[model samples]
Target: MTTASTARRPRGRSPLHGGRFGLLAVLPFIAFMLLFAVYPLTQVVRMALSHVEIQNGAFIWDFGTLANFARMFDDALAMSSAVTTAVFIAATVPLTLVLGTLLAVLVDRSALFGPIARNIALWPAVVAPVVVSLIWLLILSPTVGVLNRVLIDVGLPPQGWLGSEAGAMLSIILVDVWHWTPVVFLLVYTALKGIDDQLLEAARVDGATERQIFWRIVLPLLAPALAAAALIRLVMGVKAFDEMYLLTRGGPGDATTLVSLHIRNVFFDRLELGYGAAFSLAVVLFVIVVLLVSVVVRRTVRQGGAAA
Candidate 1:
């Protein structure tokens, strides 16, 4: 009787916990991440800290010191590339915020054009980065470009848009702004739409101006969304490569030479794999600094709004 009752006892464990097939089903995804993401990251860290040397026609890896990083610091062009990258980030992020938030405000206020304008705004975001770069290159070309033609017709100089140093950097930043404004517009507009209508109504009852309501209530609520957008832009800025490569090729005498291109030049052009890895790690460190700054700024803005 005791054995029969024990055999009939209810089992509380789910199939996922007890079944081999459940764990097996997710094993492939785990393996995929390990193979692609974890393995590459491990290799990068390993390469970043070591010194590679060729002896007797065989490659030898010595992993103990930061000699590669010391070389990276001594390199002047690498430092300049870091500065150029910083400038690019500073220019693009704020412009995207202002343009995106303004467009979002307009769309949020309009009933008729809201939906249509919103769809049109996403057109740039949907396009591939490569395609966008190609389109801009054609439009900004020196001799046969439409922009130059327009300028010439209006009796202005046919400037070397991408051939000059200052022009190259400005053009790259402008292109980034054009591509990312829609992204900002969509993000900020969504946040604006999510506001409680009653809050705005209450503000109106208290004799608040539209500008006053926007500065006090609307802006504060939008802080989190704005911060998120800024973070996205910041990361994108760190990873900026294709546009600078495709458009400027890091040319015009280091004018648009971002750190990513600098890394490519080190690894591919110069064939210094160890140094490239160290520089890549430096780029990661720079990204961390940018992230910390963004977080502090966001927290400060939110606190100020709350205090007000």
Candidate 2:
């Protein structure tokens, strides 16, 4: 090749050249994350280790150690609140997955009222959780609540829905299911549309019944999407705060107090910034563990299915 042509042509692939544009692109994203997510998280951890005391009409900081963590375990109410939150997540995740998947499968097709059904499912998601909690609070009030009024009309006793410790957590779970089911419905419904029709046709041609086709062909194929929806709902449910905060305020003798609620009270309400940071870290650990377990389980299931 001519000297000019050789010069114009590129040399062998170089790592620096390959990553030059990509590095530039990722720099902005990294900067943004560092500024927003990472910085706040680091600050929380820092504050959790430091003490805040009033000095000369001003707040002063002092370094702390295991004292904050020790306090967390020692406080029975705090420990119970954490346990309650975990139970809330365990209860809600499965319920949301089952209901969301069923709704998605049922309303996925283009029927005369398909749009209407889909719209109704999506409505709850569009409404704010705080607003929904307020509305439910009014409807389920001990005496004058419309829900209790309806039950009374039907000859059943009027019950304290949010007011009672026994039923408060259940009420929160219901509200979560209502507001978030629509999200899963929309996601899974879209996933359903992407499933190949030829598989269904092939199953039918092989003399498989409709039920057989659904169980053997459709469900197996939809497992990944269902897994995705379940993970999304799991994370959201674990971190749920707004509905619980608005509806119950962790009331009725701490029956409905969730981990997030406890964290908020520690950091903001009680002004235990350092201890709150430790609590927040504990929560992060929980989230990480759940996610890792879920990924492993999904992989194991997929491997078993492949082997079978």
Candidate 3:
């Protein structure tokens, strides 16, 4: 039966109207994103493919090829830098999550200082990563650094912070935690705010302790937000470059070199633009995979909870 006419729309407004409105609303954002983000990204990729040959005291792009990737494999410093970057991400991601959660919980509980405390917590995130790195570099400097001076005054031995290979990655991690933890805290705190007070009241009335309510009710509800925060941090952590560069320039022995830094060095320093582009694309693909896996894990957790 041809029921196309009978299945008539009950809409008061045309479908195209809504789409038009949406398009209008999003046009500025799309234009801005394209101009600032996409255009630059495309330029980088293009430059990466272009051949860079040293001539007349400047690197000149001759043509494009996969020569950069081939050279990257043989470049020991590049490979080592990539490894160091991965290690930094692994070390910092978990710490960021934990500290973020703790700060979020504290901020949510404050009756008087919530706004003040939240702003303070968010301060580090607002500070430019490069500036933060520079500040820390001074604070952690081996000679005449305030940190070491304080340690000496406290009768503790002063230790080299970003100056040595052994402590450089840790210093970077600390800087990362200081800067990025607020991002997670804000997300988790927002999720916590959306939770129903009635459910918490019910749990309290049911003789559930505070810890029990948090673990059983609050945590499960906030899992998705936590997962999202972790995914974001994971991506950011893996691609960390600005702070690391300012803090250590990959340091005394390639200690804090991350993938982004390696890519920068390949593209700009070594003039292997094509290889750098490939490496950057690899980072993007890795981030996409991580996000996909995180989404799957969150779904799996929801399904398991439902099953139980």
Candidate 4:
């Protein structure tokens, strides 16, 4: 090629990755991750594995071994709280997914009220969790609660909704579902909207039943959204302390104690910051593992989609 023509030609691909502006654009995000995400994670790790003590009116962290982990494991309340957290996740994730999906489908399929239904579905999510907890606490209170008042009107005894173990756990789960289901509904509903009406029409034109179209087509399309919403719910589920703490105070016994609640108790109440820090690191590890798995699953799904 002539020198003039060669000079006009580019030698590399577009500057999507290597341009100066590209680096500048990404610098803030990188800084944010380092400052907010990485730094906090490192701090948690350091605190967890250190011997933190008050010396000369100052908190001192001496780098040490994993004694805090051992201490956490040995604490009966800590182990129970971890198990309770798992149980809470196991209970809420499925309930939120099922209920959210059903609501999304009902609203999406509605010819007239779909928009209104979708908006209504998001109302619960807009309400703050703290506010929701307070509301539920009043509702579930044994005496003078509207629910109990109604029961008394019907001659049935007013039950202690948050007083007993079974009732406390069940009440927390229900409250969690009520508060978080709207989030799943919004996500799944958005996913449903991405689906083409032409596909559903084609299925119907081929004499496919409503059940067949939904099961074979709609649900499969919604799988990614469902998985995402479920993971997010599980993450939030581990933080289920706000509702349970407000409603039950983790009490009548340790009946409603969650891992976060236990962590708080150890840190603040028991003055065992080292053990709490270790358990907090454990929680961070769990969250990181879950997020990593989510990334892998999403990558696999994208590859499968591209292959198909």
Candidate 5:
């Protein structure tokens, strides 16, 4: 009787055992964030709130001041940079989305040339932004540029693509669109591939026109992917520094001077570390707000899609 009761006894795990194992599994990631992300952010906050100076190869910090942040209100260049960033985002994001989705649809419908076209479209995304900037810089050069040469040969005058305010802004916007559109295309194309063929077939069987099927059936399914792509592009646009920095260096009377470039100038050119840190924090706050809005938008899209 004793042996039978012992054999039938329930076996249970201590609650702490699983918890410990889970913590152990995530320990490396936590350590990585602490060492790389959190620590640096703390330093940035410290710098932002202090007056920094270097003397005799040593650093000094005079804490307890909001002067750096307060100066932002009077900083005309910084305000202009913000406006330029806004313009850049407004132009690049929509163009990238529309062109990318169109290309994805074209590739999806093209049975014979789909694979080849997909590979070609993905080529620009694989290239580094710095390299893309350099390549475009050469192509947009007023003297000896292939584009200008073609224009000259066709009885058109050469234009200074980066020499004027409008031209520089437009050139950067176009380059950015060219560089990032491929990313959106890949995302939308993958989403397209995941769509059920039977759903489309059923729509056709119901006598729905191709346009109607695309607008009513296909687009609704693709909403989540579109929202995700837009979020990614918006964030990337906000932080975009490489191409603009390398290609134009915020030139043509500050027309292409984005916030990122402005922050860089504060840190290096002006050697205003404290001010730069404060500016960077403001940008971080902006990014966080953008992320929050994106989350809300994505959730709403998902809920709407489920309802449909």
Candidate 6:
């Protein structure tokens, strides 16, 4: 019996053996982070705490003050940039989510056009942001532009899409929405595909109307994906610079001056490297905090849904 049992025993590697290989695989990633991410982040922190000046073509760092950070409180441009950033986020994130979700549902349900629509929706995301901005710039230009020409042909007055304060902000917000809504659609559509059809069939059998089934079953199932999309767009919105910079250059009159643009201006335009570093650090911290809060909220939501 002992001999039979010994022969029947299956041989397999222990988890520790697999874990060692996993560790070895991750060593390169760890080294890369230390070399790139950690090193640069340390340098940023050092610069943030110092008073940096260029003397004789070399940077002189006086590492003894919090004036850079303190100046943030009194800087009017910084305050304005913060408000602009907030408004940008508020305007873009929700529109992106709602439009994305709606598009995703429409595409998912349309059998004949689903594949075509999916491919077309991904086009904006694949195009470079700078290229997108350039295309929109021509479209929104005041004179000799396609949009203005169209408006004139329609017997409507041509408006300055990017030449007024409200127009610039609205234009940038619309551009951001156009660019990112596709990404959110991709996320929500993928989630929609993963949903089991049996649940819907069962709901239909139970006399649930199409709208009721969607609102009751499909939307709940899509909650996590929606949350994930929102978080991604939130982070992207916070760091948005390229489109606004290319389209309006944070104008007209600082209307589209996001925090990232403000930081860039401080660093390169004003040559206030230390203050920019401090501001950059603060933005990084804010992003981190937002990420943490989003994670907590998502978890709570998931738990609450499960409980319900």
- Leading candidate by TM-score: 6
Q: What is the TM-score of each candidate against the true structure?
A: 0.88, 0.88, 0.82, 0.89, 0.92, 0.93
Per-residue lDDT of 107-145 in model 3, one digit per residue for the tens? Answer: 998989999998899889999877897788778988878
**Candidate 5 lDDT (Cα, 0 to 1):** 0.92
Name the regions of candidate 6 deviating beyond 4 angstroms.
1-20, 304-308
lDDT of 3 at 20: 80
**lDDT (tens digit, per residue) of candidate 2 on 1-308:** 69998787688955566778789979999999999999998887777777765568776878767677777889887889878977887888788878988898788755887888988889999998778988888887887789999998999998888877878988998888888888878877888888899978988999999889878888878788888888888779768899899988998879999888888887778877778888888778778998999989989987998899
For 123-191, candidate 4 gives per-residue lDDT tens digits of: 889897789988887888897677888899999999998888998889999999999999999999999
Cα lDDT of all candidates, in order? Answer: 0.90, 0.84, 0.83, 0.88, 0.92, 0.93
- Tens digits of per-residue lDDT for model 5, 103-218: 99999999999999999999999999889988998899999678899999999999999999899999999999999999999999999999999999998999999999999988
Clashes of each: 0, 1, 3, 0, 0, 0
**By lDDT, is 2 or 4 better?**
4
> How does candidate 1 score on lDDT?
0.90
Tens-place lDDT digits, model 6, residues 1-308: 99997777666745556778899989999999999999999999999999999989999999978999999999999999999999999999999999999999999999999999999998999899999999998899999679999999999999999999999999999999999999999999999999999989999999999999889999988998998898899899989999999998899888889999999999999899899999999999999999999889878877997899
The segments of candidate 2 whose C-alpha lies over 4 angstroms from its true place after superposition are: 1-19, 54-59, 300-308
Worst 10-residue lDDT window for candidate 3 reads: 1-10
Order by TM-score, highest first: 6, 5, 4, 2, 1, 3
- Collision count of model 1: 0
Task: Give the TM-score comparing model 3 with the true structure, all chains together.
Answer: 0.82
**Off by more than 4 A, model 1:** 1-14, 17-29, 53-59, 289-308
Q: State which candidate, 5 or 6, has the greater TM-score.
A: 6
lDDT of 4 at 206: 100
